[model samples]
Target: MGQLLDGKLVAASLKEETLQQANELREKGIVPKLTIVRVGAQPSDLAYERGALKRMAACNIDVEVKELDAEITQEDFVKELKAVNEDPATHGILIFRPLPKQLDENAIQYVIAPEKDVDCFSPINVAKMNVGDKTGLTPCTPTAVMEILRHYEINPTGKDCVVIGASNVVGRPVFELLLNEMATVTICHIETKDSSKWARQAEILVVGVGVPRLVKENWVSEGTIVVDVGINVDKEGKMCGDVDFDNIVDKASMITPVPGGVGSVTTSVLAKHVVKACKQQNGL
Candidate 1:
């Protein structure tokens, strides 16, 4: 069996580093604060909020939650977001996505200040991330994947990397990150032909297509490093990753489990971003 990439241990290490930074900022009389804007009460959103709150608290960062009504109007939502953007006290801002049907994301994406957009919601941050700018905040999920690899000492440089799914959030960003590490990256989407052929060629495989168990044992080669970024409920209502862990474990040299993998490190990445935003905003 392949060595399990333990995200919990990586997350703990990141939290420890972030906590130290936050303490240093505190000594300089600066407190890092994150404001979370959540609309309605999505189960998933609430669950994430709980984890974020816990992580931030552990890192000595403060959190302010703005729980908006489910039927909030676009104008009101934009107004509220702008208010948060302009708040000098706020160091980082995180907005739970897929806002109500009435509140269009495109119209509001730019409302958050880029400096405080800890989750890379702003186009400015996205552009910076695309260009491999280190000053920008990256999407936490992709950063978590990188953290896992870093923790495992898995260098991507010059490796044959295949990323399934090209969504802006995880897949594309991961591809860019790996490329920045000098890895030869191939991104596959639904329209891509012979995707499995690409998968078979990968030294590092990142699956984030939201399809549970989409990658089978034959999809990977022996000694391949697999990172599953998908969180989906299988037909039986059980949580599973994009890759079939049971069958692929032996084939992979290293693999991350779903619940205990990338998902676990994301909150710590968010905490780390909040501290970075705070330091940058304070000119520290």
Candidate 2:
């Protein structure tokens, strides 16, 4: 049987280090502030925001929520976005995505200053990330995945890594991060027929698809390091990961739990990004 990867413990450690640095900055009179630009009142978005608020408060980071009505005009929305971007006191900007169809999502993302884009939503940061530049902030979820590996001292070098899902937010960024670490990467998505065939090849497998328990026991190789990034409520309303924990746990070398895993680490990574942004903007 594989050992459990305790993401809650790992997240606590990461947040502790970040909190120490944040306190030091506070002593120097620099407050690390993150402004969340939320457009609609999405239940899922609200839940995420609540969790983020709790985490940021615990870390002593200031959070400003810029809530706009869903029906607001695109021009006014962009104007509101610029207000936060131009604010010197605001170190990081995390925008809730899937804007009203009237607004061009890509255009709004470009409007955010790259330095203030903590989520790495700006094209400038994306370009820097693609070319393997580590200066810009990485997408928090992917960074959390890397943090998990680092905390566990799991080296990806010379390993065959298979990444399931290919979205801009998690999968693609993770694939790039793994490649940068010298792992041979294969990215599979919804379009990929028989994804299990690819997954069985990985020494390290990272899955981000939202479907609950999509990976069966036969899908994984023995001793493979499984990082389950999915946060889904199963049909029975129990929180679960992409991989079937009970079954696959015995087959894999290590696995991360759903509620206590990547989600917690992601919030900690966001806090870290805010501090980094504060330092950069303060010219420190």
Candidate 3:
């Protein structure tokens, strides 16, 4: 049986740490607050917002959700962001992605202050990440991946790690993070030739291509640690990861399952960023 890298268990532990930090801040009369700007009522966005709010409440972090109309003008959205940016109580700001077609997402992202961009979607944070600064709030999903590795006591230092994808959200940031840990990182995209050759040589394999069952059993080496970051709905309407979990489990030393894995850690990591931002803002 493959050893399951249980992200729920890991996330719970991280949440406990965050709760302690929140309490510490509360004692100092500084309440860490997170404000979420959600542009629409898409089911996925709603679900994520609900989950984040619950996590924040459990952590004793103050949170406010700004539900904007889908028809809101781009200028109005920027104005709202400016208000949040200027609010002393709001230490962290998150803008749910894939805004209405008429809105300019890039312009909206730039309006958020770098200090409060806990989502790490702003160009300033991206530049910090690329240059290997540990102080900046990183993209939550990639940070969660690092947290999972730490939870498992699997350091990536000097190891051959293959990240299969180059997306700004998951793939590229993770590759950069692994490199920061001194890992020999190789990133593969859709056009890569014989990608399995890279995977087969990796001590650690991370798949985030967003395609269901894209990484097969033959692509991985025995005893390799596999981290699946993809969450896809199959033709059968079942949720699955990029890796062929059933087939790859026996060959892998450790692996994360889709529904209960990386997705579970993401929100908690975001909450942690809020706490970090609060600390930095207070000079604590």
lDDT of each: 0.94, 0.90, 0.93
lDDT tens string, model 2, 89-197?
8999998877778889877878999999998899988888888888887888998999999999999988899999998888999998998888899999999998999
Model 1, span 1-284: residue lDDT tens = 99999889999999999999999999999989999999999998999999999999999999999999999999999999999989888999999997888999997887889999998889999999878888999989999999999989999999999999999998999998998889999999999988899999999999999998999998999999999999999999999999999999999999999889999999999999999999999988
Q: Rank the candidates by lDDT, best first.
A: 1, 3, 2
The 10 consecutive residues of candidate 2 with the worst lDDT sum are 97-106
Task: Give me the overall lDDT of model 3.
Answer: 0.93
Report the Cα RMSD per candidate: 0.9, 1.3, 0.8
Q: What is the TM-score of each candidate against the true structure?
A: 0.98, 0.96, 0.98
Better of 1 and 3 by lDDT: 1
Positional deviation of 111 in candidate 2, in angstroms?
0.2
Q: List the candidate 1 regions with Cα displacement exceeding 4 Å.
A: none
